[model samples]
Target: MSPTTLPDGATLRTARPGDEPGILHLIHALAVYEREPDAVENTTDALTRSLFGPDPQVFTHIVERGGEIVGIAMWFVTYSTWTGRHGIWLEDLFVDEAQRGRGYGRALIAALAALCVERDYSRLEWTVLDWNAPSIAFYRSLGAIPMDEWTTQRLTGTELETLAATADGGGRDV
Candidate 1:
């Protein structure tokens, strides 16, 4: 996709090589904003491998201003059996605290929505912390609805490892 020029002169475009550091920085900042500063274990090298590796499974869009990254939308594709098509799962969306209210966040999300339409994807979805009232209001203004009936579940660390150990492997290599 071609780079888009935002109203504030920031350029929004897909991330490329050498953008790992900036992207990781935004991710760290996002963690802090989410009140989980110590939860991020991501590294620039890991990002390079996941986003720029031979078989990339994830992608990112960045907003850059004055040669510095000020916002990012990191996402991946998901398949829905009901739709029989793929959709986008937005993993992260963040703009620098100082850069808020300039429409950077909206631009990033709109870009992802555009991608969804262009690819015939089923939907564009992400989760917001319930306590993030500001973000919830912003999303509501953009016409997003809550998936009230669904609850997110996850297993990590020892729990994840223990579950894997319980798998029989079905006589195949794990």
Candidate 2:
């Protein structure tokens, strides 16, 4: 889709294949905000491959102010078997340091919410770190609630690889 210009001299638009560098730059900004810059495992090539390659597994939207990318939001569709419909899981949202107070963050999220409503998505979800007070407040202002009953868990390193390589313990390394 073509970019949509906002009245405030900014634009909101879907990401394109040519936006790899800009997206990666914002990804780095997000990682830094999360206090783990070195944990970003994605490079521009990796982002381009994952976002715009043959499979096109993810979607991103960007906010540009005065010709510079000021914010970004990346999301993907997920199925909620219990709900039996598709929902949007926002994987990352970030506004550049210098642009934080300019309403770019809210505009990015509002655009995403607008899309969710337009597409009839069953839900729109994202997680904020517990210590991120600013983000938590922002989310609360948007009427988002904490999924208190759910605890997120994940397996990584050896455990993940082992599970991937093994079956239900029949001949799989008991």
Query: Over the full model, what C-alpha lDDT does candidate 1 score relative to the true structure?
Result: 0.95
lDDT of 1 by residue, 1-174 (tens): 799999878999999999999999999999999999999999999999999999999999999999999999999999999999999999999999999999999999999999999999999999999999999999999999999999999999999987788688634555
Candidate 2 similarity to native, TM-score: 0.91
Model 1 ranges off by over 4 Å:
169-174
* lDDT (Cα, tens digit) per residue for candidate 2, span 1-174: 467777687998998878888888898888888999898889889888888889887899999887777889999988889878788899999998887777777877888888878877788898889999999999999889999888888999999887876666644443
TM for candidate 1 is: 0.96
Q: How far is candidate 2 from the true structure (C-alpha RMSD, Å)?
A: 2.2
Error at 151, model 2, angstroms: 1.3
Off by over 4 Å in 2: 168-174
Best by TM-score: 1
Candidate 1's displacement at residue 162, Å, is 0.6
Per-model TM against the reference: 0.96, 0.91
- Give the best candidate by lDDT: 1
